[model samples]
Target chain A: MILNGVEIRDSFAEAFPMVGTRLIITADTAKWAMIAAKTVTGFATSVIGCGCEGGVEREIPESETPDGRPGVSVLFFTMDLKGLQTVVPNRIGQCVLTSPTSACYAGMEGGAKVSIGKALRYFGDGWQIAKNVDGRRIWRVPVMEGEFVCDHDTGSVSGVGGGNILILGASRAETLAAAEVAVEAMQKVEGCILPFPGGIVRSGSKVGSRYKGMFASSNNAYCPTLRAQTETKLTPEVASVQEIVIDGVSFEAVSACTRAGIEALVALGRDKGVVAIDAGNYGGNLGPFHFKLREIMA
Target chain B: MSGFVLTPRRAFETRVDLAGVLPGVDLSGLTVGYGDRGVALAELFEIGGSVGDRLTLKSGSALLDRVGAGLSSGELVVEGDVGDHLGQSAAGGSITVSGSAGAYAAAELSGGRIEIAGDVGERLGAARDGSRRGMSGGVVVVGGSAGPRAAERLRGGVIVVKGDAAEGAATDLIAGTLAVGGALKGKAGRGMKRGTLLLRSADGLAPGFGDALEHDLVMLRVLARRSPDLAAFLGGAFKVRRFAGDLNAGGKGEALVVPAA
Candidate 1:
């Protein structure tokens, strides 16, 4: 099936179950909030490398924030509950606590709660104080600027990760541009994140590797360099490819954002050098939900 | 008007321990249904007025200890002075005392409103002597002066004292607002963070609060409107001296002293 003259790949995007927590970090101004958020989400591109995947979910207005300050909501994902417990406090302590005039709170209130502030309160030594207002517990830790008011615990829930799409183009620059556009679109969608660097993955992986110890290898089927020697599926016009990976609280959220992103990038295919938009999958066997590219685009 | 009212049948010389009587008792379920001593509530207090949405105790001086402990909802009004632990762990509801009350007036109250028109003993809105969490949430308004440690380890909630407050008011307060209209004799907001302690006079600002700033805050205007009792001290147009420290605890909290006009 073709969407806007670009072929819709029949293959589905695979995803895995994970745990996620949302943190609302606020500061004196939006700049500091963004700075702290960026740091907290830094190096958190994938669980394979960073043990977590996190990104800025949205910019919250002061009225919606806990402390009536400009803040940003961030979504952090980990492969397991224990990983989440470790990654949340460490990142918040190192990044948010170190930022000036910043306060961190749990965006999710109900469900199973994890104590990020309860653990980080040690940074305040014996000076930490607990405050409970309107049924919400917050910790007041003394910082250089004043006090950092953070929620004692943050709530965590099961989420989905590893949803991905590959953008094929005639040139490396064209593929990168298409991927950037897709990332920009996905960033606007709620409850979903493109955790890769600049939201683009250059080295797409396959199920297994030929190396004795490696669990996965590169996706040689779509490699422009190996097209002459391997069983290549890429058209002769396709010279470069980039992938966009999404992590979301639910399969529907990830699929919806992925669809929007793929459609937006596919619309750019009418231009020169743009080839097609496809998704990466492990033969529809690894994940629970199979998001068919044609069905999603249609 | 909607609560439980216990009017004593006869004046007794012996002090009656009313502790553990009001636990899990809501306004509708409370009744002086008549029994002997330690039997039903009717035997202790005369069954006169109809049980409404609130429980009102009239002309009782023999009552002592845990008068309104662990009350979840509704109102409990005591016409006479009550003993210790007036409204302990009162999750939700209002408990008003026309007369004075003993120590731990509203200790560890999670939610609700407690008002004492008369004076209260020490530890007015504090934790249960040794607990970490004090009045977690709710509002406790004292028309008269409060004893020492008015809001110790208070996690969240507002404690407003219309009259002068004693020493060690708001010590180790984690978060919440404490407003004192009269002069504070002792340390205020010691080791406090992420909470606001507003005092009418400069006496309440401890040595920990460093710099002072003079400015008009719009939020103060809103706060005054919500609490008219606070309006007497924070009312009209006034310049506020802001102290930023408790620097010992990272100095994050603010102590706003209403400058004399």
Candidate 2:
């Protein structure tokens, strides 16, 4: 399939199962809320090394939040339920508890719960107070700034990770620009995150490597430097390749985000140094969720 | 599902215990103990309706005590004034009392909701005999005034009094929230241990409370969000003067007094 003369590959983007949780961090002002949110979502770009993948889902107005303050919603994804349990509390305690005038609450409910405030109440020593609000327990830990309130626990749901879009451009600059616009488009879609630096990955990899100790290595087929030496998938005209990786709470979110990224590139036009739009797959062995490019665009 | 339309047979000489008569009584299965004798409920009241999770009682001259005591689940509607121990030990379900309720209303309740359209007597949502923790779970919304010792020994849950509260309100509170819309009698929050008492009058705060500071607490916002009845009472004023108190009890509890507009 082609849109504005850009090739839309017929293959699908593969995604694996994960456990996800959503949390809301509210503060006296938008600045402090963002500070706490960025701190908690920091260093969490990939399950490959960071142990979790997360990003700011959206900014909530004071009228919409539970605490009548500016808030930001964040979504975190881990490869296993146990990982979610360990990461949620550790990140919240280290980031939110330390931020001034910040309070955390569960963004969603009804699933496996991980301790967010139930575990952090220890910081209060013996003065931590627990109150039941609309059937949900919330803990208020006394702090220098009066108090830091948080929900007892947060619920987790099944998620999908590793949904990607491969952008091949005629030059390095062109490839990076296209990937940048694609990432921006994906960020607009809720429940999904492009978990890479600047939301773009240049060193896209395949499962396993020649080195016995390494689990994954670079995709030689898409590399411009090795185009002639290796079994190249790119034509001679293609000079650079970049990928936009996405992790989402559901299959529909992943598909919607993929469609948005592809539409953005199509809108950018092929004359802008674009070559092709494709996806990475491991022979459909790694993940259960599959999003075919043509079908998603259709 | 049809519910029971219960009407008292005759004005009795003494009070009647109407506890545990919810969620599962039929036309023939209904029974109540009056003083010394076991009276068949069908013989006393006109019990007619499809049996379901609803129970409606129409009272007469006789006072009905413990109307919804120990109610675990279902819906209950009381038509007239009820005696003491209303909804005592209630775990789940909703109870709506159209008229006034006697002392110890909702005492020792663990879960569910109790809404009273009229005034409530003393010890509202307080602990019963032998139990240290009282009203551990659930919400109690009183449309009118509340008597003394409201929310005494409360372990958890929310209690909102739309009108004035008598003396000793929130006394001996063990964590919970008591928001009074009108004037609070003296000595409120005495011996409190980790609890919040919101008073609209801002008077009657004891000397034990120190460190009085004015600020908008996030918990108040949450309370206003969860209970519309409270939000209406709080109006637009979000600022509150917080007095950390009951110093004799370690000084952890707080009394948030809303200033006059």
Candidate 3:
């Protein structure tokens, strides 16, 4: 089916389960809060290499924060609960604890929990103080500028990761523009984060590589340069493609984010360099969750 | 008014013990001490209303002792002044006294909440002779000042006093937190081993304390946000001058006093 000259593929995006946690980082100003959020989420675009996938969920206003300071909400996803428990503290301890005038807290509530402060409290040596406030244990470790207070543990959620939507267009510039528009729209959805560089992946991967010991490699099938030699999914007119991957607190959140991007692109239609909308799937075999393109657009 | 209301038949000749007699039941078979003689509860106060979650005392006297002691569940309300050992050794549930409480109020309390609208006498929330802890868990909110030796040997829980505390507040605190919104009179924290005494005035601190720099404490802000009712005692402080002390008693305690206006 097509909408305004763009094809709506029958394909679906395959996603799998993940353990995720959300942390709220606050600072005297919004700039530092965002900085800490970016730092902790840095190098965390994929679990295969980075061991986690994390991104800024949103910015919190002063009135809502624990200290009445400006804050940023960030989400991190790992392949398992144990992995999440490891990566979150390392990031917060190194990045946030060192950030001046900043404090971290458990942003999400309920479900299972992982201790972020238990691993970092040793930084205080024998000076750290542990107390309970509103039933959640908090650890306060004195720092040079002041004190670094954080929840002893934050709640972890069973989430969905690897949800994707591919923006295929006739030229490189148009394809990038289309992906940009989709990213802008998808960011509005709650409980989801785009964990890629600029929320778009240029070198999208298939399942595995021909080289020994490599688990994943580039998607040659969707590459414009390999259109002639490989089993290319791209049409002769299609010149470039961009992948927008999503990781969220729930399957429904990923689906909503995907639908938001599709809605935004479909509204812009052919005028924004006409092409088609497709999704990534491993023949619907690997992951348990599937987001069908046509069904979603319908 | 809906729950059990026990009003005295007349002024007590001697202090009476009213422990373990809870609500949600009839007091017909329940026998309690009236002075040295055992008397039926009906022989004392005029019983009114059916059994319910709350047990309200229409009036109180210095003769009423061990009020709501060993209360495991349900609410107990006292409308007037009560004698010593008010809510003593209660494990759970909530006890609220609308009037002043005598000495040993909530002494050896392990769990549950106690709220007093007026002054509490000396040795408030203090442990008895042999026990290692007093007011071990739960919260106590005193709307008015406290007498000397408040929170003695307190191993756990929180106590917030809205007005000045007399001498010896937190004298032998073991652990947990006690925050006083008003000035602390005379020397305090004499034998504090491990705990925090958050107060507004530091003028009365003992020589056992040594000045630690005025520093920002995020825990105060966090506590203020978590429990707003106790925020007044924390002085809504972003920074406080810490006195690391009771050094004569092993030094793990602190008296965090908010800067003077």
Candidate 4:
């Protein structure tokens, strides 16, 4: 299928099951809230080495936030519950707890609850006080800035990860620009995160590596430099390819991200050098959620 | 008047308890014991409404005590002034009184919401008789003034007094929130262990209380959203000057005074 004169591959984006939790971080101002949110989600681009994938889901207005302060909602995802439990508390305690004029609240409700404040309250060193308000337990930990109020626990739900879109462009700069637009659009999709660096991954991977110790390696088929040496997936006209990986709280969120990313690129038109939009999948062997690129872009 | 309307037929000198009668049932055969006399509800009250969970009492008698005592559920609306022990030991559902509620209103309330649109007598939302804790759960909102010792020994839940409160509010409060939208008389939060007393006006901090700096508390925003009546009183105040007091006690309790901005 073709959308806006750009080719839409029939392949689907394969996504694996993940565990995720959302956190609402509020501060006296939107800037500080974003600082805290960015800090909490920092270094969390991919699970390959970062242990988790996280990003700022959206900005929350003061009226909607628990503390009546400007806030940001962040989503953190890991491979398992154990990994999620370990990463969430550590990230929130170190990042949000340390931020100025910041408070943390659970963004999602009703799931497998993992303690955030219940565990971080010990940082107050016996001075932390637990307050039960409106049936929600909150911990007021005295910090140098004043007090950091954190909700007792945050819930983790089953999530979808590794939903991807492949952008094949004629030039490196054009492909990078198109990926930037795609990421910008995907960022607006709710309950999802583009977990690659700058939301663009240059070195897309296959299932296994040439070496024995590695589980994944570079996708040589999409490499322009090795197009002559191997049976390449790219055409002679395609010079650069980049992939945008997404992780979200649900399959709908992943699909939303994919659709938005493709639409944004399509809106840029063919003259922008984005020739084709495809998706990544391990031949239906990876996951149950299959987001078809043609259907999404169509 | 169209629903269940219970009007007093005679001046009941005896303390009448309307605890068991519920709406949506045939009340013609219903009877409640008043003092030492087993009074048939049909003789005392002109029951007129159809079957439902809502029971409205018109021309409420001040002599009617324990109007909804030990009420576990259902809605009981009183049109006129009611005597003491209204909604005592109330566990669930709601009770709205258009007129004044007497002493011990919603005392020992474990669950549910009680809204008194008019003044309430002494010890509103306070501990029940011979009990250590008051209002272990639930919410109480008084549109008018509240008597002295409001929320005394309150262990949990929230109590919002939209109007002025008499002296000794929040005295010995164990936990929970008590907010006074209007003037609070002297000695509020006296000997309190823990809890928050949000006041709109602060004549002066009662003795033994230390002045704390004006700080921004996000939890208040959460509270504001939860209780619209209390939010109306707050007028959207996210920052408040705190006065931690009852030093004679644990000094954990706080009186958050919102300065007019």
TM-score of each: 0.74, 0.91, 0.94, 0.94
Comparing candidate 1 with candidate 2, which one achieves the higher DockQ?
2
lDDT of 2 by residue, A126-240 (tens): 8887777678788888888888899999888898999999998989999899889988888999888777787888899988899998877989999989976899889777899
Writing each residue's lDDT as its tens digit, candidate 3 over A116-233 gives 7888899998778777644567888878877798888889899999999988898999999889989999998989999999899898998889999888898999999998889989
* Residue-pair clashes per candidate: 15, 0, 0, 4
Q: Tell how far residue A143 is off in model 4, in angstroms.
A: 1.4
Candidate 1: deviation at residue B260, Å?
10
Residue-level lDDT tens digits of model 4 in B45-140:
877767677788888866778877766667888888888988898888788888888899989888888988899999998997788999887889
lDDT tens readout by residue for model 4, A216-254? 787988888999898998977799999999999999999
RMSD of each: 6.2, 2.7, 2.1, 2.2
Colliding residue pairs in candidate 4: B3-B49, B4-B49, B24-B51, B24-B52
Worst 10 residues of 3 chain A by lDDT: A127-136
lDDT of 3 at B114: 93
* CAPRI tier for the interface of model 2: medium
Residue B184 miss distance in model 1 (angstroms): 1.7
Residue A79 deviation, candidate 4, in Å?
1.5
The DockQ-based CAPRI class assigned to model 4 is medium
